[model samples]
Target: MPPGSPSHPALTPRRSPLLTLVAALVIVEALILVGAAVYLLHGLLVEDAAAPIAAIAMVVMALIFAVGVGFCGWGLLHRATWARSPVVVWQLLELAAGIPAFSGGSPWVGVVLVVPAVVVLVGLFVPSVSAQVSR
Candidate 1:
């Protein structure tokens, strides 16, 4: 703890199961992004493979999801108290998206994602986890 070295208090790390749950969710989101990227890349390169506009849209969506996961991951890692609410919102959106994705032989994808979503939602509601995140 050398104060003259200019350590940042804002960079302090907090450990919590909730953060782990959030990290899991981020990982699941990255998997989904990879899946979409693979499909989109194939579509773009193949001759008359599929609807070009639709393929492009999927790639864009994947990029957006990746960016979002990064933002949420940062907040969770930093243990920002206010980040919980937005993260919860992201989980709900993921839940909605998982419905269709899981139905088409994507069960594992949904399972990986939904587990963390549940954890995050529960943590946000419970007093103990909330207090830890607040710290």
Candidate 2:
């Protein structure tokens, strides 16, 4: 197949492996956030009236983040250039959060948080992924 031809992998604007990985990570993160939001909302409804405002606030934050991340992931899968910046910002935030979590009592939580952020950041910055997104 010729370059830029429909069947030519190099010319096709397809999701590079790295981009796919980043998108998958973002989607997974969104799902987790959504799950947390659901759990928080459920607790708010089922539990006593203590700290209802805090629980409501957390639920709202989680839902908002879940939607944002989910939208970014969808854009990434579609190769939308605008998606890159937000994802990068999110990864940086995640890294910062992970660093603190790492020092806390739960090392496993830190590892879980840090590893995916690092992977997604590296993947997003890779030459192939960048080029694909730039197209």
Candidate 3:
């Protein structure tokens, strides 16, 4: 088929409001991860007591999540069906981490993580959003 054939899906899918919100949330999460990575890297450079290995590990962790989740969000924005599973898995992991943080005396951090996870979870599962992405 030709690149612009009528039967072919457009490179950018029509986005529902919920899907837009989901994409925004995912992007925000990616930005947060990047910010953390930068902070860790800065600490690694400046803080003498900070173990270099631990700092590097933290930066790597942040980069992994930023790239992985960010790619999933980008794919979701393009309406790729494959994006949904990884997103759901990421949200589940976020929820799992949030729950422990919530009970571990850092209620604020838990709320910050959990609220978006819950919102994304609900938004993704909405019938209209799901249908649009699946198509």
- Ordered list by TM-score, greatest first: 3, 2, 1
Per-residue alpha-carbon lDDT of candidate 1 for residues 1-135, written as tens digits (9 for 90 to 100): 664453556554456676566656665666767777777777798857558888788888887877776667666666667667677788898788666768879998787667667766776667655765675
Clashes of each: 0, 0, 0
User: For model 3, where is the 10-residue window of minimal lDDT?
Assistant: 5-14
lDDT of 1 at 11: 53
Q: Which regions of candidate 3 are displaced past 4 Å? A: 1-13
lDDT digits (tens) for residues 31-110 of candidate 2: 98899899999899997858999999999999999999999999989888999899899989888888888678878878
lDDT of 2 at 126: 92
Per-residue lDDT of candidate 3, residues 24-62 (tens digit): 898888888899899889888887745788789889999
Evaluation by lDDT, superior candidate among 1 and 2: 2
- Candidate 2, residue 10: lDDT: 80
Candidate 2, poorest ten consecutive residues by summed lDDT: 6-15
TM-score of 3: 0.85
